[model samples]
Target: MPGKKRILVLGSGMVAPPCIEYLTRNPQNEVTVDVASAADLDTHVAAHDLVISLVPYTHHVAVIKKPDGMRWLGLFSTEPASIKNGNIFDTLCHQLAKLLSFKPGERDLVMLQHKFIVEWRDGKKDTITSTLESLGDPEKYSAMALSVGVTCGVATQLLLDGHPALRTPGILAPYKKEICDPIREAVACEGVKLVEKVMK
Candidate 1:
């Protein structure tokens, strides 16, 4: 298709399907999933317009640093190994998932909170806290999967749409309100809840 946007997605764990589904909803998007590794990283990275790194956080720095001369937007999510072999990381993840698996009709909850402190020269300090809490439908998606996957999808779409803050050259983290608000709003539209408070 003409004017299609190609997206390369790294990792294929639980969260991946939702993210991939969300992106492909747009007819112009062509998303390809890959198990990110040293051998195939460059070739895949160079081929796609954007790369979503859903691989484990420990591997992020290495993945980001590997494509030296390549330019592509990236959205990072935390998870485990990308390799398909029966390694320790893969085994541990499998055992952990089995142990934590939710029973039928049971919903999973996910909560994320961030606190920031600001102080004036006069000595007064104020604390700001932001929280996101999402509950997943037992018949549909897990809270962890929905929260991470939808947020990743939202960020990826924002980047593709050329959101001002996200278009910057190097690595981008959604720490700022400009970048985060849109994601938060989009995630909420997908049924995730968000709250913010300030305390002096």
Candidate 2:
């Protein structure tokens, strides 16, 4: 496990070949891909340390909640879901559809939230929350599609490089500077401007 990396890619689709190609080029990495359905999720996902879902966005959250053996997942979903929902795909679909249906010239958002609580030596307590929002190009990159795609690619690189900062993973919010800043820069280079704001 120290020298080699295992990556599992779900759903063989138009996006699968390129990601598979990129990972396999590294001799230390082994990539396995499958057309997995919801019924077969836990079994298909249990083997790999790093998982990437190229399936429809609907299946992304389902891949994340399994507390079975795994280190991380690169989920393509644009919305968040609660573990209690049981049917993650259905809940996520309803959220995704609303975002997609926004009219041109209406701002679409990519929001990230980080919640922190601290207890001081004096027994004082503090709760802090930081929120980041990246607004999309209303006319061109409608629904922030360009931003999301580029951010997903950046996340893959972060996982491949073994970035240790996001070691504790469930859903990766990319709210911190390490993840968001690079992604922000990368998307900017593509000429799809992402206007970002932060609040605490």
Candidate 3:
């Protein structure tokens, strides 16, 4: 597809499909999935306009460390020997894939909540909380996979669409209202439930 935005997806785990499906829906996105290892990172990352790391979070830093020019979105985690050696990384990838496989009739759950305390100058304070609970259907995506995948997908779409906060060069997190509001709305549109409340 000429003029399409190329998106490189680094893993083929359960989460990859939802994210890939979401990106491809735009017609302007051309997404490629690779069960990529360290040796393949440079070539694959350099070839795409955006990269989503659905691989084990440990490898995210290595992807980010790749030469500039590509944007990325996904969960991130710690360093490991796999970060340096392609062969070790390949072995670990196989092991991780085995662990992530779901059996028939199996289901998963994900719950995320945050509480914030706000203080006023007059010494009054309020408590605010936001909560999200998602349960996976055995016949479909797991809660972990769907939530992570859809969130990554939404952020990727926003970047491709030239979202102001996302277009800046550097690592970005959804800690700010500007970044979180759009994502929250889009994720809700996908049927994920989010609830917010205030207590004084």
Top model number, TM-score: 3
Tens digits of per-residue lDDT, candidate 1, 101-136, equal 678899877888999898889998989998988887
Best by lDDT: 3
Off by over 4 Å in 2: 36-40, 57-150, 184-200
CA-only RMSD, every prediction: 10.9, 12.7, 9.9
Which of the two, 2 or 3, has more TM-score?
3
TM-score of each: 0.67, 0.42, 0.70
Pairs of colliding residues, candidate 3: none
| Per-residue accuracy of model 3 over 63-142 as CA lDDT, tens digit each | 33543312222123343333334575565544444444577798888888999998989998999999998999898788
Cα shift from native, residue 180, model 2 (Å) = 1.0
User: lDDT score of model 3?
Assistant: 0.78
TM-score of 1: 0.67
